[model samples]
Target: MGCVLSGLKWPRTPSKDHVTPEPLLPTLGLTPQQQQLLIETWELLKQDIAKVGVIVFIRLFETHPECKDVFFLFHDVDDLKLSKELRAHGLRVLSVVEKSVARIENVTRLEKFLFELGRSHYRYKAPPRYYQYVGIEFLSAIRPILKEKWTPEVEEVWKVLFTYICAVMKAGYQEEENKHNEKTPTMKRLEKSQATAM
Candidate 1:
C-alpha cells in the first residue's frame, strides 16, 4: 500500500549515499469516519502525483528563483534522479492531504490539519518567509482547475498546508542551530575566531 501510494521504483544498487528521508505524516486528530475518508481521498489522488509534482516544481522555479540554490544543490545528473524521487514523494503527500480535507465538514478537524501542515513547512526546512509566496503560487496554479469549485474549505486547507510547511522550516532552522552549537571545541574555536575577526 505504501509503495503503491508513493510510486516507488526499484533501485539497481544499494548505495547508501544521498538518501532522502520520508516525510512524516501530519496528525489529523480525526474521527474514525474522517480517517476512512482521508484514506479514500489519498487513494484517489495517488495517480495525480506526477502531474502535481511537475506543476509544483515549475511554479517554485518560476516564482522563487532565490530558492534555486537550495533546491538545485541536488541538480546534478544523479541528483536529478533523486530530486524527481523527492518531488514525487512530496506531491503524493500533498495530494493526499489536499484531497482528504479539501471539503471536510468539520471545521475543527480541518483547522487542526491546517495548523499541523503549517508547522510542517518549517520542519521540512522550507524558507521561513517564502511560505506566503508558495501559498499564493499554489492557489494560483490550482485555482483555474478548481474554478467555481473553490470554497472556503479549499482555501482553509491551503492556508493550513503552507502555514505548517513554513513552521516546519522554521523548526528545522532551529534544529540546525542546535546542531551547530554542539560542534567540537576546534570547530567552535574556529567559528569564534572568525566572528572576532569579522
Candidate 2:
C-alpha cells in the first residue's frame, strides 16, 4: 500500500505561465470587496514567503532530527547553513508560486512547471510524500506572523497552489514510469533471445 501510494504523482514545481484563471476569490465565499481586501492581505504576506522558507527549514530540522539526513542530501549541506545560491534558488522558486496565490488562472503551464520540478527532485531522493509536510509546515510558520491578515481567501489560494504542485509531481512520476517501461520491453526481448540461443 505504501509503495502504491508512493508511486502516485505529486507536483513540486511552480510555473509563471500557468496562472489560475478564475481567481481563488470565489472559493473564500467572500464578496468582491472582501476578496479585494484578502488579495491585498496576501500581497503583503507574499513578500515574506522567502523568510518563511527559512523559518520552515529551521522548524523542520528541530522537530525531525532523523530527517536531517534527507535535507543534507537534498541541500548538499552537513549542517543547517544554506549557501547564498541555494537561498536565492529557493526564494526564486517560492516567488514564482507566490505570484500565483491570489488567483486560479493558468493550469497548463503551472502543471508543466510542477512536473519538471517533481522530476528534478528525484535526484535528491527526497521522499515524494514530503511535499505535503513542507506545505503544512510553511503555512504553520507563517500563520502567526500573518495574524488577522490571514483570511480564508488566502488559505484557498494556498490550497490551489499546493494542489497544482502535487498534480505536476504526479504526472512527472508517471512519465518516469513510462520511460522505464519502454526500456523494459527491449531488455526482456534481449533476455528471451539469449535464453533461446542457449
Candidate 3:
C-alpha cells in the first residue's frame, strides 16, 4: 500500500498498459433456503423500495459519515433528510437491488452483473468496506418493515448474501486496480510523492 493523495493510504497506483487480471474470486453459492429468504423478503419490500432505499442511505451515512465523499451526486446532501436527488439515487439503487435479487437463482448472470456493478462503484472511488457497511445498514433498515418476520434465520441469510456479493465486487475492483498498476502515469505520481516524502 502507498499514500494515494494527502497521505490517505491506498493501494499502489498501476501503469496505463497493464493487462486486466482474470476474475479474482470464485463463484459463491447460496443454499436454496438462503435464496428463498432473500427473494421473499425483497419481494415484500419492493412495494416500498424507495422508503427502504431512503432508510438505507440515511442509516448508512449516519453510521459512516466519511462515506459521503464517494458520491459526487449526493456529496453535498450530507444529512439524513432526503433531497430529491438523493431519493432518486436511492430509488435507482434499490431498483437494481430488486433486479439482482430476482437473478439470485441464476448465479452466472448474477456474478457478471455484480462485476459490472463493482467496476461502476470503483469509478465512484467508493471503497469496499463502505459496501460492507451498506450491507449492514440494509438489514437494519429492513428490520422494521419485516416486523416479526425478521428472525435470526433471516438476518443470518442476508449477512451471508452480502458477504458473497461484496467478495465478487471486491474482485472486480482488484482487477481494475491491477490494470491501473501497469500504467506509467500513476507509477510516476506515486514515485514522485514517495521520493518527496522520504
Candidate 4:
C-alpha cells in the first residue's frame, strides 16, 4: 500500500555546491523564444479577450460548480452565459491577464500587480485553490481561438506565465489571510480544525 520509492535515495544531480539557488521570488522562467511566442499569440487573443473571458468562466463553472459560489454576483443567477454580470466579471479577469502580459518585461511590476490581485481575491472570499482553475479555464478558452497558431511551445509559455501568476497570488492570499487571522486567532484555530476534519 505504500509507495515503493519511499525508501529510495536518488543522488542529487548537481551536488550542494554546484546547484544554483532559486530566486527568492517566483519567476516566469520563460526563454526569449517563449516570450516571443506569448506576445505573438496575445496579439491575436487580445482582439477576442472579452469573448474568451466569458468562455473561461462558463467552462469553469460547468467543470467546478463550487467556483460559482465564490462570485456572489452570479451565484444565484440562472443562465451564466446570458448573465451580463458574468460577462463583465470575465472581462475584468482577462484585463488582468492583459496587464500581466503588458508588463512581462518588468518582473517586479508584474509580480506586484498579480500579488495585489491575489490579495483582492481574498477579500472577495475566493479561495487560493480556485486560482489554478482560472488558469485551466483560460487555456481551454484560448486554445480554440488560437487555432492553428496554438502549438506545444505556445502552451508551454502560457503555462509558465500562469504558474508564476498563481504562485504569487497564492502568496499574497496567504499573507492577507495571516494578517486577518492575527486579529482573529480563535477563528483561525476553528478554521484549522474544520479543514483537518474535512
Give the distance in Å from residue 86's predicted Cα in candidate 2 to where it truly belongs: 6.3
TM-score of 3: 0.77
- In model 2, the Cα lDDT at residue 143 comes to 80
Candidate 1: tens digits of C-alpha lDDT, residues 1-198: 465645667565768785645344343344555444444533544466565555655676667767566554433435333466657655754664564355355545554455455455545655557656655666665655555655565555556555554554444554455566679999999999999999
Candidate 4: tens digits of C-alpha lDDT, residues 15-52: 76674433346778777777778888999999998899
- After superposing candidate 2, which stretches have Cα over 4 Å from the reference? 1-42, 73-86, 99-103, 185-198
Q: Candidate 4, clashing residue pairs?
A: none
Stretches of candidate 1 above 4 Å error?
1-47, 73-127, 130-132, 182-198
Per-prediction TM-score to the true structure, in the order listed = 0.47, 0.59, 0.77, 0.80
lDDT tens digits, residue span 1-198, model 2:
555555666334647775434212112234565445545756776777667766666666666656567666434554444655435645764665564443434445555566676666665565556666666666677688788877686776556556556556655655655554668777979988999999
Winning candidate number (TM-score): 4
> What range of 10 consecutive residues in model 1 has the weakest lDDT sum?
73-82
**Which numbered prediction scores highest in lDDT against the true structure?**
4
What would the per-residue lDDT of candidate 3 be over residues 1-198, giving only the tens digit for each residue? 544594864336666866545865765577888889899988788887888888888887777778787766776764546488778878887776776788899988888888878777777787687888878888888899999889999888888778878888888787666666677997879889999999
Q: Give the TM-score of candidate 1.
A: 0.47
Model 2 residue 114 CA deviation in Å: 1.3
C-alpha lDDT values of all predictions: 0.55, 0.59, 0.79, 0.86
Stronger candidate by lDDT (2 vs 4): 4
